[model samples]
Target: MAPGSMGTVFIGDPTAKLPDDLLVEVISRVPYKSTCCCKCVSTRWRDLISHPDHRDKLPRSTLAGFFHATSATEHHRHLSHGYLSVSGNWCRHDAALSFLPKYESLEILDCCNGLLLCRGRKSTDPKTLDYVVCNPATEKWVTVPATKWSWDMSSACLGFDPAVSSHFYVFELVPALAWNPIKRDDYSIEAVGIYSSKVGVWTHPIVLDDPIEILYLSGGAFLSGVLYLCSDNNSVAAIDLEGNCRIIPLPTPHDDPGGPNVYVSRGQLYLTIQGASELSFWVLEDSSSENCWTLKLNISYLRLFGIDYSSSEQFYGVISAHPEHNMIFITKGFRLWY
Candidate 1:
């Protein structure tokens, strides 16, 4: 075999090409980074590597661990963040994001699929910050341009599904004015700033005709080009890529003490509510049209952790659900469990 022009390797004859099966077998054994580099060798190579039939034989990314922030303590006034590997194989990964550009501070805002959205303060100007989206697997990143009213934004979330499209979006929710007496304390969303990676620019903040009230700006789930957020008025606010918004009422009353957690598991939207002693899981069905949540599972804390619930002491809180499995991660006191 000899190296030919345009990244082609010829065997015996200059025009002879390798078989696709053999290429797949060879590429599957190499590291994921090298496999990605192989895609740029030629158009034929790229097509073969990206083909649906060859996906199973290709080197792909997997969920290895989680990035989390610890609560601020008296000794440590600032929050500290770290990564926890699920399989106790953490040495191979660099969770510190050392590949990104130097910054005064970097805070992880959200993560979807294998991408992370972070806020990095400029080293020279600590008061100025930029939103950066990066893939730790490939060490590729892009900085999002700031919106005109970024200072008024309350919270932000990432919306990306590589299986759906190569592009990604960032949603920044702008809260209603504080002096608005009618919407006070409701946490109503007055406007939304949407940034599209495909266009490489942010659309002017879209002002909502009717403000949507949300409990908090913490948890959100993005699926099928739509973002699902927990609503304060016993419902969920579903916003699509076009900025259209709708409200889906919960199947049961929103009486959970800590509010319901919304997430995507196994390509489905799910909600988990923690009660006094039991945890109830709900799945959103027929989400394309009329949305309805169906109860999937309900289990008591005693059965899950063998611990009786106490009214004065909170036991566990659901952190997240497995994206590809039916497992749930929970935090109890200072320990994490699944």
Candidate 2:
């Protein structure tokens, strides 16, 4: 271990052409800020070290405010019941997976800024609601204004813009008088409440039925602004933040609907078609105006053995065509064979 002014540090031999495994091992040593700066050492190190999973693998040395993205499969337990199983560096290092205290369930997931919004995750702070957001990497944190969920999700979001700092607000929920608790009445937010991270406060509130479909759904996707499933009287559409509603035409392939559904990979959409004798996958190409999906690859071995394509989201960035050997190994994505 090499000692440094900032903190105790370890340096891997920069000259040694370490294999992939050893390289990742060297990167696993430093804490966050130093790790960020150490990225300047070399290109290969930067690539392996800069990965999100690597950053997340760092220890969460905070009381609260570190939200982790987990696959839906993980049940009520908060310690990432199932997730990317990257451990034991290729050469010699400890496990790359993160192991933090199990109690911080209220941590919020902030992908862009790498800040986590959370309440208390430990048993010690269970009594009261504490508003917080933190960057687990640097072990830095901040306190927010509110941690109450008295109101419904309210088709809302935490957003920031040039005119206003960051804050939380409902997306499109309409406002109305609070329910007369004594009498019968409906309570709603006339406007969604926007929360600003930088400003560290929530705007007044805004409520909207934003997505006619969002009403039917359980939750919303936070990426690419937000994708809300909405249904009008006549049409069902996906509404983006810009108020642009794009209708996704449900495909009715002449073939069996029993076949595997379509999925996204490498930024393109693909459909997995099952067959009695051979399995075929079609790539949906949007290179031109005509929206057409063509059979791209076929694997003959699948005829002898059944195949199921697990997309990135499903398998923690690892693609699996078979279920039995779920954690067999990681390999460079296979080239599709048509």
Off by over 4 Å in 1: 1-61, 71-79, 88-91, 178-186, 288-291
lDDT of each: 0.78, 0.38
Which portions of model 2 show Cα errors greater than 4 Å? 1-113, 121-127, 147-192, 209-338
Residue lDDT tens for model 1, 1-338: 45664765555533127788887888899976677788887777778787878876876646668877677789975556778876322224467788889887777888998789888778798667889999886789999966655554566889999898999999987777532535655367877778999998887777777787776634889999999888877778888877888888877775555777799988899998777778899999875455578899999888887886654375477878888767888878778899
lDDT of 2 by residue, 245-295 (tens): 454432323232123333333434444543433445655554233345566
- Cα TM-score per model: 0.76, 0.37
Pairs that clash in candidate 1 = none
Q: What TM-score quantifies how close candidate 2 is to the native fold?
A: 0.37
| Steric overlap count per candidate | 0, 38
